[model samples]
Target: MTTVRAGGRLRPPDTRGAHRDAPLPAPPVSRRRGLSSSRVAGWGFLAPVVAYLCAFYLYPLYRNVDLSVRHYTVRSFVQGGAEFTGWDNFRQVLQDPSFGTALRNTMVFTLVSIVFQYAFGLALAVFFHRGFRLAPTLRALFLIPWLLPLIVSASTWSWMLNSESGVVNYALHLVGVGRVDWLTSPSWALTSVIIANIWIGIPFNLVILHSGLQNIPAELYEAAALDGANGRQQFWRITFPLLRPVSAITLLLGLIYTLKVFDLIWITTKGGPGDSSTTLATWSYRLGFGSLLPEFGRGAAVGNLLILIALAFGLVYVRVQRRQTT
Candidate 1:
């Protein structure tokens, strides 16, 4: 019970087990009200990117999937007679005689090109990292191949590798070696294209890896030296670990670029010498565009397969990047 007075009041007795005075709790913060201008600006900036991806990437992907399933032709478009074909195109492409050969060639080309490109690029990067007097000039010179237009580079390489009067043959003659048919021969044509690809790819790898090497702290090398580690030991122990992320990025990009290589191959061999050098991309081109039959459906199927492979590689790259960041 409580007794009340005129100016001062006596409070009622507490029914609780214990009684104590506690400070009032703070009011809850409204998240939206509390957001900083920076956060608002960040979301505002992201809105356009979100809209663009939805409109461009997702819409096109959906359309490509739809197109792959449907039987839409040039005549069908004019006649309004498009229909859906259930996996028939994929079956036809799988059954094609050149499919196996094209797959093999593409795989071989990708593997060989990646190996040589990375190896040569790493070697060049290591050499440049040693601080040569003319390294900057040499680095700029190496980038010339990358800067050249694809058609120009392919044409130049083709002329140089020509068996009869090319510079390659002339050099061989000077070295007391017999002339070899570089582009005309089935065995040599693919190799020649691969060499050209390696040249184009080397600069890209070098740029990436050299930047990575430059980012490594000099103190690490100095410490390793103090611990009696040689150059090879220091590279494997310190340099390799730090360069892993860059190496992964370079490899993924190189593989993707090498997989889709077409212009060089087309200009060099045109998948010629009896389809010996026909890659998946070139094969798809030949089937849908180059052939009399013009199997558009089959070509679409091959393109879809390539897309899947690229997606898988992309997923792998994402996972690796995530792991590295963490």
Candidate 2:
């Protein structure tokens, strides 16, 4: 030994032994600064949709609200000026005699259409869910009406329902039932429109319900069967409960579509035969464009009412959805 530390004696260093110090580790990169490429791509993809809604949906909604408070015309619009009228337009729309009739007719059409469309659609969906021969082909054929242009379908249905020289009358004649004036008679005009609407709506309902039925897991049905539950019991307990969400969505959509129907009634009857078939949409159009002095303000009010009704329905739908999800 040659040296000693503060409190101990030191031995001589051995040549064969070695002492090593580990190198300091590099500093870690900040995780906060490291952006995920996938997350950035998702935001990039969603930007276009966000921009579109702001431009189209929000802008139009703002314009509609602005128009609802003003007295505007084709000339006023061209002149770039309009006078403000607060709630007078709403008052006029409410005071109109035909407005009540339109409201009643729209309500009837919406209710009846919802009932029949859902009933037939649910039935057809259940039938096809069994996977019969040619089921796919039949389902495709059924969707054809939905794929067709609304104007074309309306025109075709109108021609077929004509009192004279139409297929319906010809068939009736063959069966000795005589001719029926489907569009010309006030009594039948609204009913005829409702029937056509129902026909057009059925395909959509069927497709939705069919998809809903298909999504029900087969194991649930098997379990029910194993427990000695019959077909009716299984449907009430399993199928209906599972389908509530889809049914709610379909019903709300159908109600909105039916309430706003104008083209079919216009093409067929033009709300004619003493305005018996005029729904809210047709009446609003008549008030705005069909009159000598167009009532833009009043039409706007009616449109606002329609918007409110739709919004109410949407709120109800959202609430129901939230409850279900929770």
TM-score winner: 2
For candidate 1, the TM-score is: 0.84
Model 2 misplacement above 4 A: 1-44, 223-230
lDDT of 1 by residue, 163-224 (tens): 98899999999999999999999989888999999999999999999999999999999999
Determine which window of 10 residues in candidate 2 has minimal summed lDDT: 14-23
Give the clashing residue pairs of candidate 1, or none: none
Give the TM-score of each candidate.
0.84, 0.84
Candidates' RMSD to native? 5.0, 7.3
- Clashes (backbone N, CA, C under 3 Å), per candidate, total 0, 0
Q: lDDT for every model? A: 0.87, 0.86
Model 2 C-alpha lDDT per residue in residues 1-326, reported as the tens digit of each score? 35445457665665343434545666556653355666788899999999999999888777766767889898985676889988888888889998899889889988998889998999889888989799999999988888999999999999999998779989989899978999999899989988988889999999999999989999999999999999899989999999989999899888877778888888989888887998888887887788888877777788788778778888887887798789
Task: For candidate 2, list the clashing residue pairs, or say none.
Answer: none
lDDT of 2: 0.86
